[model samples]
Target chain A: MEGLIDGVLPDAAELPGLVADLRTARSGISFVYDVIEKLAERYELSDAVMVLDHPELGRQAFRSARRPIGEASAMHLNVLECPEGVHGVPGGVDPVSASVAVELCRIALDLDLYRHDSRHDGLTGLYNRRFFDVMFRRCASQSARYGWSFSVVIFDIDSFKQLNDRFGHMLGDRVLQVVGAEMHHALRSSDVAGRVGGDEFAILLMRADRENVPAFMSRIRAAVEANMEMSVGFSFGIAEAPVESTDPAELYRLADARLMAAKGTKR
Target chain B: MSVPASSEEVRLAPLGDSGDEDESPPFDALELEIRRLPGVVAVGWHRGEAMRACLSVGGFGLSALRSRAVQLARGHLDEPLSVELSDVEGVFAASSVASVRIIDILVAGGEVEVRLGAGHLIGTGRAGTGPEGAALATIRALDDLGIGASIELRIASAVVLPSDLGLAVVVSVVDRHDGSEHRSIAYASSVEESAAKAVIEAYELIGEQSRDQAQSAIR
Candidate 1:
């Protein structure tokens, strides 16, 4: 493949094709993998690594290698503002085309980020109601098909309107943000949490029933207490599928009814 | 699905549709479509509560954007979605005016001094402290520039939006010759600065309205 790079700037001819590939990339990791594959094929490099700075994901390194190695080569191709450069690039590569390729990679990452932002709540960083419902249905379908069990929890901040009226909405928003962060930290990757309403939250726990929920709630409470300056309290209701009901809407209603009962006892 | 077509009806709409296989999310497409409507500057869910769209001054496509926003939000939200349409013409228009600039503002003891600059031209005014005083100083500075006679500016209110949304100052200026009130809301990090800009934008709005009225009369 050394003959492919024999020209003064052979990579310049590859720019358009690289851009088209970047355009069709589904995610940043896949795009980096494709770039590494292309570099390996075009330049006969055994390995490649790309270090990227993303607004949301921060700094991350993606690596591709033909075989397990003790150490990667030290060569770097400077791309965009990535002064650290893309490591493992061969010496003969064109700087101009390499920079353009990296820039296209950056734009592709941004497009994915926008796609993510749309599905999440801006203030709390949880799945918004719309996306949450979609995910919930998928989980429910899987459970029904395979006879797996899961639990649904619905809860809201107690006397939240009073809290907003007394302390103002800024403090109220702060409480919500802190609670959201706590919920995000408390749940496992398989579990999903969403901001279903103002000061309201819902969680879907996979492979778990109501019996396994208190520990998760305790973790959220502990985190909230550790992070927040003010005392913020909430009530929750949990119902398990197959044990409670198979219907998704019925599960939510059961959880909500229990939530109302819990709130009633608190008062 | 068919959305409620009532142009004034505002309801809670959900976020994005994840079913889309497109590169960009549906929320972004909705936002882009709304922004493309005449006079819209920004569109988003207001802190995950309501859909809020900010419109530019003299913008004409409110009804169109409102309906589209409702349609876009239909399946994404389950609650009563309130669509908030705020006129941001005053704050945004001041930035895009090209000529005018608020050079300096000094509040000392019981008085305030304001300096207005447009290219090489400068105007100065002094008044008492507070938003009303800020508006007074701005009008005086405009008078110094030989442009204040067309309207009489007054400070209406300087208030903060909930959840630290920022401070906004409302200025109601009367077209002295025509006896019509032109109310403008300008937002800034500080109340005094918002008041100063609100007064200036109200003046600009009055000038545009008068020109429009004159053209209409001629036609």
Candidate 2:
């Protein structure tokens, strides 16, 4: 991958724009299209395609060429993040074609890594609201594909603002970290947990449709309560997704509603 | 070898050309230039889609270059991989907890295909023209002082049926290619037995490919 970037950046100062383009891309497909279009301009190529091994979509390609995707010899573009097939660009101009191909790949990966960082809470190192939104959609897709049920659990540190006011933000932060850590440890590999708010955490459990979600939530709650200060408690809510609605927004709304109802019980 | 063995510079184009629709330097050119670099004894890229040029700066070079060599080879890839360069020598998917052990950077076609454990492959010419050559070349691709001829085995999944009536194992071989390829599709009554059967089947398939290569050569 370094061979694609070494020293070439000095002459190809415009390469930064390629990376910048990655930031602007809203989705993976757009990231790929942005690369292909830019490389076509730089390498004087006619067409290209992005073959990606998306976790949900599996091995798939987004082609720009009017003709067949072409053979291996026609492959020009390559990227680091592409796990499966070659990220190739066909009919490219010499030297520039290879360099741009490699740069685009690196840039795309950088964009992804950067994007991932942005979706995580710096303190707890858990997924943030941004990732939650994305993963929720993914869960929808997964559930539909496998007919497996998923659930969303949302909870808040009861009277968290009070904890911050009394214990100083440092201790409050420490408690939040502890809660996040416990949730992380308690989670199954198929689960996604995010610190969506300061003291509020959300989890999406894949394959929990048939299982006792409340029981699972209670386990996590117990783990957190065991580690948390006596004054700090939690309220919880869970909604089964891929059941009534494939949309995560709907699930979020339902979960929030249930969360409020659960808090009412505490009151 | 005319290209200097000591300094192998794989130059890429894409000079932010405003008007040039050119892609970049050809893999063949990069391969040729890479061959010129010092200590680089052999070069092979399968089918051009799978790889590019890799360089291990200062010391580690062969593994770095193998990714780039994959740009020319042609084959089916199964699952993505990240190498654990540490003592664990575990092969995990990029998304998992493990980070890929990448000592150097090379223009790889896809993921890093050369598992340094594959044995005695460093500085050898490309393999996969047939079967035995492919397996041997695979070993040579990651040849180090004491490491060679080792395959990185990863199990994608293992499931025990109700009451252990049957067991299933998906044995993932992370040797040179990434992604899923079923060398042997079989079922067994025991998890241990099933996994063993899968490995044996993969070995048999590789052996057959090698023999076919030999037979074709003799013809």
Candidate 3:
């Protein structure tokens, strides 16, 4: 019988890898609770419950597997015997055990949330520079391995200082918000855009080329120009991977040089 | 003025009747002669009823030669030199133009000769009435200077003029080539007087070389 039950259960080895891939704290904890419920089906546990502990919300039960039994308390465990003498757990019972499971789930969820928040920008919701550095290195490595091209387009708001001087910082922030939205709209699903500095944004274009870069820049320029009320335009400098240069530092420097050249011709 | 009175002593010779075609007077020969002149570095010819030579001069002494050629030409031809100096002081005064350290002079034989460096900027706009006009005006001014030459002059250079505003003076001479000479004199500044004289001398040097080259080409 134990062998039959083991055969019916999902292979447990695959569950950990799946759980590790889920970085969202609540989602990860919820996923673990789901696996536990699936495991209980083969064993016919009288009552199975997974609870996650939230520091503020106390213990919260997230999942349960059970069968109804007579004279069980509203929140008590209902362990019933089937016709085959197998004990079955009623759903949403087993209050004490459920509470414990809820507390553990909460702890895991919180940790995942903490990790995510640490790596991302709170306002823009994009990966912060620290994460961007890691991502850039990873992408560069992949590009090197595959002999593919990757490009970074660095954009700066022109005369942002003067805008701030004339309209005050609050309006200046609104300008950034609008421009950021324009950038987001212009990027491809595969591309990543991040606020690398104040009034400066960086985008990573996977496998981009000079032929395509001008088009991309033109779109971004037109978008910003059309949407923003402020008298400003974005200056972009593109540096490609492995083609223009292989080193990320050198790529960025090339982009910077191009940007400076663009600025010289602007006015 | 105690200058030489004899024909041999004079560096300039009158524009004699060569009886050549009005427009095609063996320019190759003329260019060769102008090239052989000591101070004349380059020459260009234009074929018209009035022949002209473009003279590029290297030094100051060549200005005297330019003046003598115009004077001698006027003494022999039907129309002597006519000079016109235009208001081009601004261009003349620019440090960049002056830094070339060269001067361009236009001398008319039949076609006009404008001597400018490869890099010198000669204004050819309506504001300056074009290179041809400047050449004609210089010829008119020559007649005013009593330099006998039947040639029309046009001289324009990017050199500093001596005043805030410059003047354009035209002198017309009638029958100077046929010896029934009449002179028209119009004088403005000493600086212009010297500039016109220098351009004329440069032109003569160019003409002499042109004549020598023509003679050699035929030989």
TM values, all candidates: 0.50, 0.36, 0.40
Name the candidate that leads on lDDT: 1
Candidate 3's DockQ: 0.00
Give the local distance difference test score of model 1: 0.59
- Order of all candidates by lDDT, from best down to worst? 1, 2, 3
lDDT for each residue of candidate 1 in A1-267, tens digit (9 for 90 to 100): 123222423454556576556546555434654675566556565455554443333233344431111122344432211332355545433566556556555665566556656776765667899888887887777778888888889988888999977864545666776677666545654577899999889998888757767776676666666766556567899988767777888889999999999999998
Model 2 chain A lDDT-worst window of ten: A63-72
Docking quality tier of candidate 3?
Answer: incorrect
**Sort order, TM-score high to low:** 1, 3, 2
TM-score of chain B of each: 0.52, 0.27, 0.22
Residue B215 lDDT, candidate 1, scale 0-100:
42
Highest-scoring model, TM-score: 1
lDDT tens per residue, model 2, B1-219: 011111222122221232112211233223222322222322222223322222211122435434423321111112121211111111111111111111221122221222221111112222322223333333333343122223444443455567846656555454343333444434554333354445445543543343355445444
* lDDT score at residue A223, model 1, on the 0-100 scale: 65
* Residue ranges of candidate 3 with Cα displaced over 4 Å: A1-90, A221-228, B1-219
